[model samples]
Target: MTAPAARSLVLDAQALSLLLRNDRQMITRIEAARRTGVPVLVSALTIVEAVYGKTDTARLHWVLSRLQVQEVTPADSITAVRLLHDAGDLHGHKYAIDALVAAMALRSPPPVLVLTSDRDDWRKLCGDRMQVKDV
Candidate 1:
């Protein structure tokens, strides 16, 4: 018998906020991933966007405890800059944090899934490289 394929989940800012707000759907997906031993990831930029200007330390701690936070490496930063430039050319604007998240998702192992509220932006950024679930 073959083992199930390894899977990982990347959460965007809106998805993280929904999870913090105790949204049933996001909670269900996150808990299901946890049960299946799938690593739940949050980009550093997403963390910034999710928790910025928040005064609730306890809630922030709780949210932070739920997922693995991934930092942008030097390589990721370079790629993100390029992605931002490309997005600016393509969409007439830049989504810096989204580009960073997409870059991180691109480098993750196969079968990666992204939970995002901005489906169109992520789809454009990721370019069919990963599965995107709308939150």
Candidate 2:
């Protein structure tokens, strides 16, 4: 049987940080997706989470150059609220970025895969709609 088509790769803050630092495994994953022509996505908020005063501006720009940065619209924020609510005990202050990533993933095509260090949170937020792979 033919292999399933590649799913889009979505990066959360942790994964984005790894990529920004040129982590080998993260680069491998991103390169694989690029070679396969599958889109790699990142929420605009994730950039804010990943970048900081200590962040290397040149490296940050280089890492972001390869991925699609999805804007968080008002609708996306609403969806994040719903995701946080649906997560039962996952509150906004701690899980807002994850919820936003999940919301962005949901809006993308089906069979999305998110790379995150917070696998449990991502799993809870994404359910079965998207795949969560630990970074």
Candidate 3:
């Protein structure tokens, strides 16, 4: 028999970007991962990052409706700020948003895993404290 899914999966900005761009490899992998009941999660931050302007918004909404989305609230933002602190200086940009996302990946008894293509900035912030994969 096929092996059961042994991991959780959360989509970061890049993963959504890949899906938006219709990258065959990324789509295939994401599809298989979803088909197998992987606990996929996406943050509002990732959604905003993926959607971009007007045109992409429709597509983003359509995609989001079909996927599993986890909302990042004010409290989540606050906590993320503390966790993301000292990682780097978060200016007027999406730092708080990212922090909330990082927090989502660090949830309760069984935390969700993160799927990202960005191996530089955000990953450095969270590190091994988060179960993030480059896939």
Tens-place lDDT per residue, model 1, 1-135, is 743354889999999988877889989999998998899999888877876565377887887898898988888877877776666544333477788788898888777888898998887776767888788
Inter-residue clash pairs, candidate 1? none
After superposition, candidate 3 runs with Cα above 4 Å error: 1-6, 54-58, 86-94, 108-111
Q: Which residue pairs does candidate 3 place in steric collision?
A: none
TM-scores for all candidates: the values are 0.85, 0.91, 0.75
lDDT of 1: 0.81
Instruction: Report how far off residue 82 is in candidate 3 (Å).
Output: 1.4
Q: For each predicted model, how many residue pairs clash, with residues at least 3 apart or on different chains?
A: 0, 0, 0
Q: lDDT by residue for model 2 over 1-45, one digit each (tens)? A: 743554788998989998888899999999999998899999999
Please give the range of 10 consecutive residues that has the lowest summed lDDT in model 2. 1-10
Identify the leading candidate in terms of TM-score. 2
Q: Can you rank all candidates by TM-score, best first?
A: 2, 1, 3
What are the candidates' C-alpha RMSDs? 3.5, 2.1, 3.9
Candidate 2: give the clashing pairs: none
* Residue 78 displacement in candidate 3 (angstroms): 2.4
